[model samples]
Target: MATISEATSAPASEAEALAFARRVLRDEARALAAVRDRLDGSIVRASRLVHDCRGGVIVTGMGKAGLVGQKTAATLASTGTRAYPLHPAEAVHGDLGRVRDGDVVLAFSQSGETEEVLRLLPTVRRIGASLVAITERAASSLGRAADVCIAMGNVPEACPLGLAPSASTTAMMAVGDALALLVARMREFTPEDFALYHPAGNLGRRLTRVEDVMRTGRDVRLAAPEESVRQVFIRLAGPRRRSGAVLIRDDRGMLLGIFTDSDLVRLFEKRREDELDRPIGEVMTANPLRATAGAMLGEAVELMKARKISELPVVDAEGRLLGLIDVTDLIGASPEDFEE
Candidate 1:
């Protein structure tokens, strides 16, 4: 066999290389469109089977199709369905035990005759799992064995050699996404549900509830509206995490205003130490910007950026203070959160 550097020739020119790349992309795009046009009731039936599955979905395929299957399984799992990718070869080698009765097996085979994929169908059926096939022809053995077949019609590979899996795998992924998203819609999967599944990424952090990230209990310094500023500071002082502001609330627990360290500093900047003995509400920013407990942390960040405030108090429907979202609390917040 010739080494890669020995067998391959350099590109004639950048322009020619660019043109070839465009041709490949156009070919794949056209093939994908053809697959889209060929979609039929089979996809709907497959979606219904996946949506109604009592057990998890088990996606299986071989080679390139197996790679597509892994992505498809992840999409399904993230969008509210329980899904796992099982290698066809591994399925026969003890992984078949993962399949249960009432489970749906989604198998991908561009040629509809992948030996390993075909081998798993009998045991899957024996386990009482329904099979859904994605292939080039509905008449193929995998399709014939499936409860419903989503035919990819005829997708030509974009490779010049016409052997590599390109457009076919793309078509498989597109169809898999359609099936997964359709079922997610059927289940009415909400953003909150998605957030629960994705709890560590930027998306998860943005969708986090204000109450979940806010400083509650003693971490939040709540001062009564009637308290004097001098007394408020002395009482709120502790070794706990210091918040920049003191939330002023009425006797009934209704938030009234906010008095920040900035406010105190300004008071002492001039000869106004005597005013510290006055009621804190008289000097506080009354009816300050606030967020509700149910609001997302992203919305609170936007509010903070717009208002140029660092501390935002969270309240309930009746305006009782629940917690505070200080700038310190948003330590790992995205740069966009701090942008004006």
Candidate 2:
């Protein structure tokens, strides 16, 4: 028999250590593949049940399975299905009240015999909430009681001692994600809907509309195409916020061109101060790159990065000036967002 230290000892070589890690990964991958192969109408039925459920989903499990349940619940909620995680142990102590008629109770248990999880079966049934089980066999107490059973089959653990919940939990998480996403698909959830649920992270920022972040009103420097370059700059100099580019608009409020401060420096470099008094339109970049009003901020960022410009004009369908997107406005964006 191996002693605890012997079982936990570091590999004699780096190659050996890497091999063990790779083997563990392979084991988990195989487990997921097996679960995928076993999938049939049960998944479709479970997804439909959850999709049609009028009340929110109540996910319950124990220990590591409970942790997976929490993540599953979060995924479901973010995907447009309202869901909440309830610890099976806590349920017996009054959390069971969270389950109610019209709700779907999603229970997770590898053995299908976790005492805490199984104890909730009777109460869940009594409350009239439909039970959906993610377990190993249909004969298991939890599975037999479920209206829908997504049997994952028996997945061997990836742990060296074969005692930890590694592979099984991985399979459980994947199955949970599959079910949640299927329901999301059934609901025809859109990116706009997804953005509503994730409004604080990198994802939310990337999904933000150009118009939502673009500089508008007095903050945007709009100049008449007939105005002289010198006059446009002079008029825009006193605004509380300064934009790098001045949008040249026709009398009808349509965008004609864009002139940046860099254009002024170029005039000085070329000894063209004489042209500063000319109509700014001739010196401005005509038909400049622009983003549509409802376009995503990420699309604007990609355009600005690709064009290597510091400003992008936001316009409506008829080419009417809406606002401006300054590079400074995206300083808080993730480095990945700027990647091609």
Give the clash count for each candidate.
0, 0
**lDDT tens per residue, model 1, 142-245:** 98999999998888888776778998898899999999999999999997888788777677778888888899898989888788999998997769887899
What would the TM-scores of all predictions be? 0.94, 0.95
- What are the runs in model 1 whose C-alpha is more than 4 Å off? 1-9, 335-340
Model 2: residues with Cα > 4 Å off, grouped in runs = 1-9, 338-340
- Residue range 27-58, candidate 2, lDDT tens digits: 99999999999988999999999999999899
| Colliding residue pairs in candidate 2 | none
Instruction: Give the per-residue Cα lDDT of candidate 1 at 99.
Output: 97
The alpha-carbon deviation from the true structure for residue 57 of candidate 2, after best TM-score superposition, in angstroms, is: 0.8
Highest TM-score scorer: 2
Clashing pairs in 1: none
